[model samples]
Each structure stands twice: as structure tokens, then as C-alpha cells.
Target: MSRTPHTKTPETAPAGGKAPDPARRSDRSRRAILDAALALVGEVGYNKLTIEAIAARAGVGKQTIYRWWPSKAAVLLDASLALAGDAPTADGRTGLPDTGDLAADLKQVLRATVDEFNDPAYDAPLRALTAAGATDPELAARFTERLLAPQLALYEDRLRSARAVGQLAEGADLRLMTEMLLGPLTYRWLLRTAPLSHAFADALVDAVVATA
Candidate 1:
């Protein structure tokens, strides 16, 4: 799949409970490694991508990458999350939008998610992560923690708020509601059944409101 290299800045948190050396994190080198890793993995696949290959494309020493990340998964995870974060959901707020309108807030976030899915930069790495996670239990856990969990946490917060305001029925299961919103989106992306779009997101929000 032909795609542009991702240049969005990655979050600084390291995998495996360690911090990267500050000196190695200069803007140029960081973007180069991330772009190289994301592109190569999309081309050669996760099983075939190597630190040496990444370093060669990035024009940096293999030691430079290893000095920061423990493994190739760590580098790819960071790169994936960085490009994925470019989605400015949450009502354009830094977090989940708590604008007191539950349906609207959820729709906004879902639309942003759809947009991210459509972007080639975010699409390849995210697909790679999910495919790898299917076979690798440990990678699945780390991917959830470093990527998926934070987004789910936002949904949980919004749902809880809706319950407090009685937008949701009394004793509504928030976990299920979160899945209700996400499941269609995830299924569509996975199957390529159709283009993920704001129209679809709006429809989901409307369905939730009507059924609630």
C-alpha cells in the first residue's frame, strides 16, 4: 500500500517502564526513525521489519534506535500512536468532550476516529498493530495499554456522565454502551464493508439516543 510517511510527533512515554535518552530524541532523528519504521512495516510487514532496516532507512545507527526502544514493536507502537493522535476528537477538546450532550459528544469523537482510519498515515500502522496483536498476546496487552485503553477511558467517562444526567436509562451498563458505539465502527473498518464516515457516526449516535 502506497502511503505518505507519518510525521506527527509521538508521545514521550516509553514502553517497558523506561525513559529514552534525551540526547537521542532530537526532532530530526525521532521523526526519521518513526517515519522509517511505519513505512517499512507497511511494506515488509511486522514479522520482516528489523531494527537494522529501520536504521538504514532512517540514516541513523541501529544503536541509536535500540538506545531508545527495547524492540521493533516498541518503535512501531510509538509511531502508530503518534499518527493516530492527530485525530482531534473530544469536541476538539484535549480530552473526551463533556459538553453535557452525550450523543453529540460521542458522534464527534466517532467522526474523528473515522477520519483517522481514512488517513493512510494512521491506517497502515494501526492495521499492522491489530494484525500482530491477534497472534501475540503480550503485544496485544501493550497495544491496549499504550493505545486503545486511553480512548476507551474517554468513552467510559462520557457514558458515566450521561448516566449521571439521566440521558442513559437507570442502571445502564456503560461498558456495553461504549461497545455499542465502537463495535460498528470497528466492524466496518475491519471488513472494508464501506467507507467509515461522519454520516455513519451520526447514525450510531441517533440510534443510541432513540434506543435509550
Candidate 2:
């Protein structure tokens, strides 16, 4: 099916009749911008981050950054969303896996999440987003709506499924359960205290599952 990209992709004509394949310049620039933003946040943190600095680091025009995003918070939010887009679940969606054993599925998810929490790529941008969220309520709302809520919904779905199949107790508060699963990892990440490893993830899973 013939379709159009939302943004202009580079289309070059090599003195020929047919247009060359789309170059995906918009996508590249967007990625570069995001990379630059995340790196800057890591180096100097969110408050000191600036559009010009991001453009300079990305090797794109300042106007390019402005054309795509309004503020640093918006850029961070989009970057997080973009990363989430690439991370598909076992079902090819952004969510946890279901292996009949809720504990196992949750452990697998948390293990991977622990790795990401330690990885600089995710750690920096996530920390920046949280910092931005603290200072800017509007950005926080958008971040929650765009990233947090959807992810929470996935856990909710999984918990609901568990309940239906008698894996979860009757009238268990899925939302609180979701928080219990996520809270520790996020807290450890923010604290920068210990290594976020599979071991820690396993412990969290065991702790939460013990209560269940």
C-alpha cells in the first residue's frame, strides 16, 4: 500500500525520472537529537541542558530541534517513547510476558528492566525525565500519560489475567501490586546506590510474590 511519512524524508533525484528511495533524514535527525539530549543530561543534567547544546551535539541546525520539539522535556519524553517503541514484548507490544507463572514473567521483565536501569542510555534519559517531571508538572503529566500509564496498564492486564485464572487472590489491588513491582527498581535506579542486576530483580520478584 502506498503511504506517506508524517515528516519529510530525503528524496533525491539523480538527474533521473524516478525519485530515489526515501533517506529517512527526519528519523536520523530525530535520533541524533535524542541521543544528544540523553548524553547532555548525563553529563550536565536536565536543568543545564539547552536546545543549542543539543543541536550542536547532534550536528543538526538549532532550528531542526525546534521544528521537531518545543522543550527539553518534550524531547526527553519523545526519546523515552521512542525507546519504548523499539522494546516490544513477547506478544510484539510494549508489556510484560505471560508464561502462566506470573512470578516468572515478572522476574523476566524486571531482569531486563534492571539491565536497562544500569545502562547509561536508559539511565540518563530516565533520570532526566524524572528530574524534569519534578520541576515541571505539565511535563510530568505528559510523561506519565505517554510512558508510565501505558506501562502500568500492561501490568494491570497481566494481574487481571492472573486473577481470572486463580493465580491472584480475589479482590487484590492490581494497581498497588503494579506499584510494588515497579517501585523498588525505580527507587534503586534513582538512588544510584547499588548495582541493578538480575539478582536484585529476582529479589524484588521474590519479595512481591511472597506477599501474593
Candidate 3:
């Protein structure tokens, strides 16, 4: 499928007569490329996605895509991150919800994640990415650094807050705590060992928090 991107006018010179920002000049095309990559992955599956197809769908030349991303995996990685958006937030803040009741907040977020994992639109594309990452060490490293680390940091931040309030042990390893809370859910989602549900999410939160 082809999409006609919205045309953007050139940026005006600054008050000091500086040239228009080079990065800003390409923002429109960048957005179009990312959006196209995301949509095509959802429709065609990541294995079938290609730079040529993405360039065509985004209305840009193939060389333009290669100029920014080395491979289709990199393009898909950026597209997935774009779709995930900024850190998980309820009030537009980066940290996870801290409602004093750490268990409840964790459950809420985990349940939402369960919902996302169960979504048809997200399920296939995510599975495709996971399969690719399993075999490609380079892509896997990029995925962990660019996508997984930020999410883990958010959870660690919340865990730190809980520890400060005496809810979590002062000596608790925040990084381990975050991983413990999320690891099972991720495993289940990726392996499809069982159905992902709010009940399972709540149980996982209770189990991890009890240990912490």
C-alpha cells in the first residue's frame, strides 16, 4: 500500500540568520518512514518487510532509507520504539505509577502490558521481532539497549521509590527487583506458555513483591 505523506514547508532562518536546522529539515520524512515501517510490519509481518518496500510505502528513495538505517531490522527497531512512545506513564511522567501501594501499581502496569501482548495488532509484529533477535546477536543487543533498558530503568526507578518508603528492603537490588517482576511475564508472552491475563499479572506482582 502506498501513502501520500503530508508535505512540510522549509523552516525559516533564525533571528541571527543561522541556517535552518539540518535535522529539522528531515523530520517529516523520518516520521513518514517510521510510520510506514510500523504499518507494513503489522500488515506483512517483519520477515517479509524490506527497506525497498518501506521506502516505497513512505514515498522516499531506497538510498534515503539506507542513509539512516543500516538494515530493515534497525528500521523496524526504531519504528517499534516510536510506536511504544515515551516511557510508560499515566500522568505524562517517565516513572511508573507510585501510589504508595507498590504491589497495586505494579499489577496495574503489568495488566496493561498483558493487554498489549494479547492485542492482535501487536502480537504478530512483536513475535516476528523476537524471532529475529533470537538469532541475530547484533540486533538483539540493539533491541536490549534501545528498547528494553529504558523500560527496565522505569521499573527500577519505581522500585527505588518503594525502598525509600520502607516498602522494599533497603538492601534490595533494584535492577534485580525490576527484572524479577517483568521477567516471567516476558517469558510467558514470548513463549506462549500460557494465556496472558490480568489474573496472571496480579499473581506475578504479588509473588515478586512478597519476595522483595
The 10-residue segment with the lowest total lDDT in model 3: 8-17
Q: For model 3, what is the error of residue 5's alpha carbon versus the real structure, in angstroms, after optimal superposition?
A: 29
Candidate 3: tens digits of C-alpha lDDT, residues 112-186 = 788778886667677878787898788889999998888888889888889998998878888887888788998
> How does each model score on lDDT?
0.81, 0.80, 0.81
For model 2, the local distance difference test gives 0.80
Instruction: List ranges where model 3 is wrong by over 4 Å.
Output: 1-28, 42-47, 86-93
Instruction: State in Å the error of residue 109, model 2.
Output: 0.3
The model with the greater TM-score, 1 or 2, is 2
Instruction: Report the lDDT tens digits of candidate 1 across residue range 1-212.
Output: 43755633344423333666443456679789999998888777788889999999999999989978999999988887766565677444357877888888888788888887887776776777778888999989988898788877778888888888888888787777788888889889977999888999999978876666
Please give the range of 10 consecutive residues that has the lowest summed lDDT in model 2.
8-17
Question: Which candidate has the top score in TM-score?
Answer: 2
Assess the local accuracy of residue 87 in candidate 3 as a C-alpha lDDT between 0 and 100: 24
**Residue pair clashes in candidate 1:** none
The CA lDDT at 158 in model 2 is: 91
Root-mean-square deviation of every model: 9.8, 4.4, 7.2
Kindly state the number of residue pairs that clash in model 3. Answer: 0
Q: What's each prediction's TM-score?
A: 0.81, 0.83, 0.79
Give the distance in Å from residue 155's predicted Cα in candidate 3 to where it truly belongs.
0.6
